[model samples]
Target: MSTESSAATTLTTADLTLVRALQREPRATWTRVGAVVGTDATTAARRWERLHKAGLAWLTAYVTPPTWTVGYVDLACTPDRLLAVGEEVCRWPPVFSVERTTSDHQLFLGIAARCYHAMDTLVTKRLGVIPGVRSVRMAVATHIHREGGGWTVGPDQHEPSRTSLPLPQFWQDGSVRTIVDALGTDGRLSSAELARRCGVGESVVRRVLARLLRNGELAFRCDLAHVAAGWPVIAGYRLDVPADVLDRVAAAVAALPETRLSAAVVGRGNLVVSTWLRNPADTTGYEARLLRTAPGVRVLDRAVTLTMPKRMGRLLDQAGRAVGYQQILPAGGHPVPGG
Candidate 1:
């Protein structure tokens, strides 16, 4: 088994490079990656085997944000209630992402839906009814930067900053079949995995990824569920409003406190809101606080999400644990000095 990268594990220079590449493009092929870091595919693959088994790096997929399909909220509570509340939050379909972080004051939520009424049901009827829930905070997604290309941390960054220019935009086409397949297994997959999945040489996978990197075609991985580790108080709410005023009203909803996410959807009764509360008893003036901020005088409808169906971002379970390669540090993994 490989070592774990924790506060205690020591990192090597090679390990740092691997980690850095993942930071650049979690999906880059090992073959391509080696080319950038001055090694062959086998060498890179060997290095990765150790790093992963050691728990130095992990690759995962995050449900992209800036979605217009859902609503969101935050909850606050004691650390002791996190697991209980998290289990409850994972029961609803609209609740996409649930986290236990954010100023230690709120439990973050990511909501999704086709309309507003469905969101309302999640916040008021389902969530609010929960015995432990205190209040719900709500918001809507107006603009988003889904895990599209551009966040990939590449080799040494010796290459010029690609951030200054517009990221290349391309829809997922069959050309990326190799790349995507690799990512399906490990967002932090080395080039060897990509080659094996695409039935190509490691070099080919590497080349393709380099191109994808410049084009901004890959999605960055994220683990939003980690926040649920902290205990929190969660709640859901809604606003009563006519359809015409949605744009103005929705904006108001996004700014509410303890709100981690929001969305507009069909069946979401009125305007839905989700918020985090430190305590259930602190839900004072929830209506006036949220609805009043909306641009129009609208009736609020809501239901607390008692049971969330699924949450965003699952940790990689298929990652290898047995180490086969020489022990070494991971790429892009070196710690920066001074905090």
Candidate 2:
């Protein structure tokens, strides 16, 4: 599979099968993936290389430290500079996802920081001062019910076992950082490749990888372009639920098949969820279904995403396919005033 030819490849059913299997076990061996998807190991490896080189499908890793805080920042930009501002903001390490949506705020951002103070500095001092940014409305997540790492675009396969891993006291090891940085752009890199990059033996790389996963310090997610996967619409909704039932409401909403992100945020509209829909019309149906799931929920605002320039540090094309990568370092790792 040559890189030039791989760039033009179109997805087929076989590709989806491969993707579905990988979604369940991101670092599964080619032999295991081939068995699950009904292909030979060599063929599975070849197909995956094509998909990966084209940026149509890939795996990436993220680290979620216990003290990290997540927030959403809505930026109303000058009408003409929407894309320009988004291009700049999306490159920032702290802003994980940037969406151009059909709301007063033209650009929507998902961000994280080591603490509230870092968050404040990023929003008030950095983002707010961007040349075209007119206003900024920011809300910190009170509790995250689910994140995009758990969402799957294809049919369910057997799920991976997910026992809660114990948090290690010394999770700030240099080897862990090395693994995460390497995996952020290529989560399926071979142990030998990782060992070479980290300047460690293959055995040490394998050991660090196992310990990171076992300690819940690292996560690998299989991501693809939603439009290319058949979900063409990204819908955002804000809801007001009674403070007493916020947790229950968030959990129920997060369970919906279409949900990509669901979190309880700090604002009058306390619950926010982003969903992937087949089309714009499905928005109404999804809303009705959620209302039934949590009757006390009141709709505050809703917007259909026009374009998502970046998702979790991956630059995306207008069609939503991955085009490039940006390393999203953990909160404190990113410098202030820059993100």
Candidate 3:
């Protein structure tokens, strides 16, 4: 499809509702989602298929690395080579997110490694040598108050579940990895499909998936291109919050309508936030609102996103459509070919 067509595409309200339903219940059946979204199962499934085919929306599975430390790194690169550097960096196994931002530091990278030492080596030994890179700043995320997995395109329509499922034991067996690998590209795959890909029986695939979800070993995310969602402007913030009020402030900011990511990191600006804005001009006003609601939260730095080359496993074009995806293995883990 043409870039113009992709960028011009806009999601209808019903489409947004479907996306939100999946965000709430990633593994829920179409029948359940349809009931919640005021539609039929067939209609719900069709809408999702349309969104997925258009590259405007997608669902993927993630297995968090138990031994890895995640860091958000900012790279200042030569202006002329910024885009080149971004495209190259996004493909690195350790880097999962790459964005061009409006700041002295032109590129923002999210890196995951087995430990602090690996992260250090990646920054000083690997990233430092990249041509055109001028400087680098790294912040280890101390706590994740809210991840992108928690953000939804629309308001919550379903009531909170009163009962909690029992957490299952964390499993790192090859079978578990195979299951995760099968679902990495599409989290909504059916039991039959998962079984076919993993070379297991349907019942076994079903059991493994259930265990993974119940134990929090796997996370599913429903993502859409911001431009197609009517929120064309993306902004990032670094806030200096007092230690005593950090949790409270993080929670408050996370609850905002525009927040996509909010976390507490170890750095000069301890609180990092990413938000979607309907208009680029509204950035100052949004900051004002944040200040009003979150008292004593100082804005350390802010950057407006120019382009996102990659998000999660999806490689996006300049217009923000998922043209392809790169397989992301767990940190310090080997790839399970064709799993």
lDDT of 1 at 200: 80
Model 1 TM-score relative to the real fold: 0.45
Q: Listing every candidate in turn, what is its Cα RMSD in Å to the true structure after a full C-alpha superposition?
A: 12.8, 3.8, 3.4
- Candidate 1, residues 1-339: lDDT per residue as tens digits? 222323234446676666566556555677888887789979987887666565444454322332124345666565677668876765543454554543333566665553566556667777677666666665654432111122222222221112222222222344455355446335665578667776788887777666655554334541211112121344565455567876566555554544533344443344555554445554566556765765465544433333332334222111212111111111111110000
In model 2, how large is the Cα lDDT of residue 156? 40
Candidate 1 lowest-lDDT run of ten: 330-339
TM-score of 2: 0.91
Q: What residue pairs clash in candidate 3, if any at all?
A: none
TM-scores, one per candidate: 0.45, 0.91, 0.91
Worst 10 residues of 2 by lDDT: 157-166
Please write out the lDDT profile of model 2 over residues 208-253, one tens digit for every residue: 8888777776777788777766778999988999888888888888
Candidates ranked by TM-score = 3, 2, 1
